[model samples]
Every structure is written in C-alpha cells, then in structure tokens.
Target: MITLAGKKALVLGIANNRSIAWAIAQAFHSAGAELAVNYLPDEKGRFEAKVRELTAPLAPAIFAPCDVRDDAQIAHLFETIASKWGRLDILVHCLAFGNKEDLQGPFTQIRRDGYSLAMEVSAFSLIALANRAVSLMPDGGSILTLTYIGSTRVMEGYGVMGPAKAALEANTRYLAAELGKQNVRVNAVSAGPIRTLAASGLGNIHEAIHKTEAASAIKRAVTQEEVANTALFLASDLASAITGQTIYVDCGFSIMGG
Candidate 1:
C-alpha cells in the first residue's frame, strides 16, 4: 500500500497527455500528494496551454512557468512554492533535451553548443532543482528524475542524449550522498522508450520502441503509468531506504543482452 497522503510534489517537464511527467502527476495526485506541475514558456503559450488541459483534472497545487535555462524563473518557482506550501516532500524532474541535429549525427560530431545545451537541461537541472527542494523540506524528502538505458548501454540514434543521461545518473548519486544526512533522498527512473514528445526527437524513435518491446522479457514496453507508479513508491515512505539509484522501469529490457 503506497500512499503519499499530505505529500507535496513538484513535477517538471510535463508536455502533454503522453508525457511521463503528466503520468507521474496523475499518479501522485491519485495517491493523495499535493502537486505542483511545470510547463515551459513558449512563443504563443502553446506548451503551457497543453499542460493546463492535460493536468486539469489533477488541479495541481501550483502551475508555474519554468524554463530551467533561466535562473530567475527557477528561483521564482521555488519562491512561489514556498509561499503556497511552505515545504515540499517530492520533486519529480522529467526534463531533458538535445538539439535535433545532435540526436542523429555521429556521436563524435556533436557540436560543443549542442552538447552543452543538452547537459544543461538534461543533467544540471536536477542539481538546480534539488538544491531548492532540500531547503523546503525541513524534515526530509525525495528527488526523482527520468533517464534511459542509453545512459549506459550504447543505442543507435540516441547520440548526445546518451552522455547527457549518463551525467544525470552520476549526479543523482552525488546529490543523494550529499542530501542523505539531511534525510533527503535523490533517485532517478530509467524508463524504456515511449512515444512521448521528447522521444519523438530521437532518430528512428518508433523503431527503438518496437525493438525494445521485442527484446524485453515481458515482450512489451512499459507504460508511462508504470513509471509513474514506481515514482509513487519512491516518493512514499516505502522507499526511504532507497537513494542515489537509477531504478529501471523498462519491462526488464535493461537487464537483457543480445
């Protein structure tokens, strides 16, 4: 019985109905966690509008504009959260991005600008968010992010994201160790390929999905909800002993080999 009653969770990187973050928001809300969901600012407010519609039922405790690249926006987000909730129990970071060209080109050819951008968004943002999160939780809390198998194993078409996620996993360990004494735990969910807006940017993403399903022990790819459910447990007291880990939710695909 995983229950997050009275818990407050900040879920970043929700883009649409298919998004893993959206799924996580739903799961957390369903488990009785107060939610704060983020939508990145866009030219026409399109991205914000989409998240609003998808999370309408959840009625998140807060919906703030966040672009991790902007320090002011990140600072303001935590300030607003402090005003409304005073503290937090869970931080769900599902943010990750790489320039389109970097997703397809030879790994060695990845431009310096593209690599920097990917590492900033996909990796460093965890540290940025976790820093704010720990201050809010006087008692303790959980910090979670999303990653993929490509972080460790080689996968074609994943390109720069591989190194980005690799750094993210490594950061998870460091953050966990630093925050452990504070009773704050940090972890990540390494999910299988899903047909989300983020994954669509990867070259031959559809093929990756199909191949993952075929190779997985269950003979099927896992769902966003499954990943969300795992998140729910981690956010709950059930995972108090777990931290600095990249738990896999890939339907056993991460364990298999050719």
Candidate 2:
C-alpha cells in the first residue's frame, strides 16, 4: 500500500548490521528510495569500514561522515546531499546513546556529563537535522525517528535514554506542527525492544524482552524488519496526512495494564 519509489532518503545512525537504522535503510532501498547513509568515524576508522561493508549491497548514492554532536560535520553532510541529489525526501533519525554505567545504576547516580551527552546526540540533533532537511525539501517530505516504549513508561534499564527519547518524541511533535505549512511530515516509530548491539549494553535486556513477549497482547516482541516496514509507510504518500505522532509498533505491549 505504501511505496517510496524515486524518493531520496538519508538515513543517519547506522552503527552496524543489527542497527535499527540499517534495517530502515534496507527497507527504503527495497521500496526504491535512493539511499544515503551516515557513519561516525572513530579513531581507527574501523567503524566506517564496517558500515561500508554492511551497506555495500545497496551501493548508496552517498556514504558520508556524520557525528550528530558535531555541527560542521552535519553541515558538510547536507551540503554533500545538495551537491549530489539536490533534494531530500525522507530523513531517518535513528540516533541514540547513553553511558552503559548510567543504564545499570540509580538515576541519581547518572553524571552530568553523561546526561548532557545523551540529550545532545539523541534529542537535540534531530532539531539540527530537521532544519537542514527542510531547505532541501522544498516539495515537502517525511522525517522519521526511532524510539522505544521507555520514552513514555518507566523501564529501569533504559536509564538516561528514557529522558532523551522523551525529548525526541516531543521534538517530533513540535517539528511536525512547525513544518505542516510547508507540507513536511514528522513522526516517530516507537518500536518494541530488539536484540540490537546497543541493547546488549542494557545488562538484563533479555529479561526485558521476555517481559515484553509475555505482557504484550501478541505475546511476542517486534522485529527490526517490522519496524522498518512501519517506517516505510510513514515515509511514503500513504501517510501524507500523518505527522507529530509516535506510532507504536510494539506488538500491543504499550497498551497492556499487567
């Protein structure tokens, strides 16, 4: 029902093959969206090379460097898009991070440095990118971000990310409203837990999944591909009228009382 054929999509935050962003990139490619993906360059450049290998099959139109915490890098990234593609149709913001130590300890134990880092990269960067995206999207477009149930509910293991995601969802709504006149749509997909590399740092991530599977009405967790499909819809014309909302793709876990 939804197709993004011919749309230009830029996907940020691909850390590895297991990342939600990578999955979104694959789905976008499958739907015929011309793709460009971002990777943060580490000291050894291993991360970039790994990302390149994982994404080789798609042969993205552009593979650029982007670290959300750096403004100059982000500017260069959009500039590259402008030079190559001239316009952007879909933006997938799948960025998030927090100190692993922050995930295990009590909230009060979270350091100021860690909290600030999480908010800037996970939440504020979306605002920065959206500002850039609007300019390239004179024809209007879709802006999508990845989120989780922890944004609204208390999940002890989610720690600082819970607050960061809360801010991200809030940004989604405000951006959606502000960009409506331009016909730009912004939304977040609050997907259920997946066994991502980042999730592995959560200590008891398996227990969390088990609980989601038992408590959810569907009696199972959602997959990265399923979440990717929902994202594909949001990016396509089918969701033209939808914006400023966090669509739940959690197998009914969010609605359960028990």
C-alpha RMSD (angstroms) for model 2: 0.8
Error of 1 at 43 (Å): 3.0
Taking the tens digit of each residue's C-alpha lDDT, what string does model 2 give over 6-80? 999999988888888888999999889899998888899998999999999998999999998989999999999
Error of 2 at 231 (Å): 0.1
For residues 84-105, what per-residue lDDT tens digits would candidate 1 score against the true structure? Answer: 9999989999999999889888
Please give the range of 10 consecutive residues that has the lowest summed lDDT in model 1. 197-206
| Predicted structure 1: lDDT | 0.92
lDDT values, one for every candidate: 0.92, 0.93
Query: Where in model 2 is the C-alpha error above 4 Å?
Result: none
Deviation in angstroms for 139 in model 1?
0.4
Worst 10 residues of 2 by lDDT: 1-10
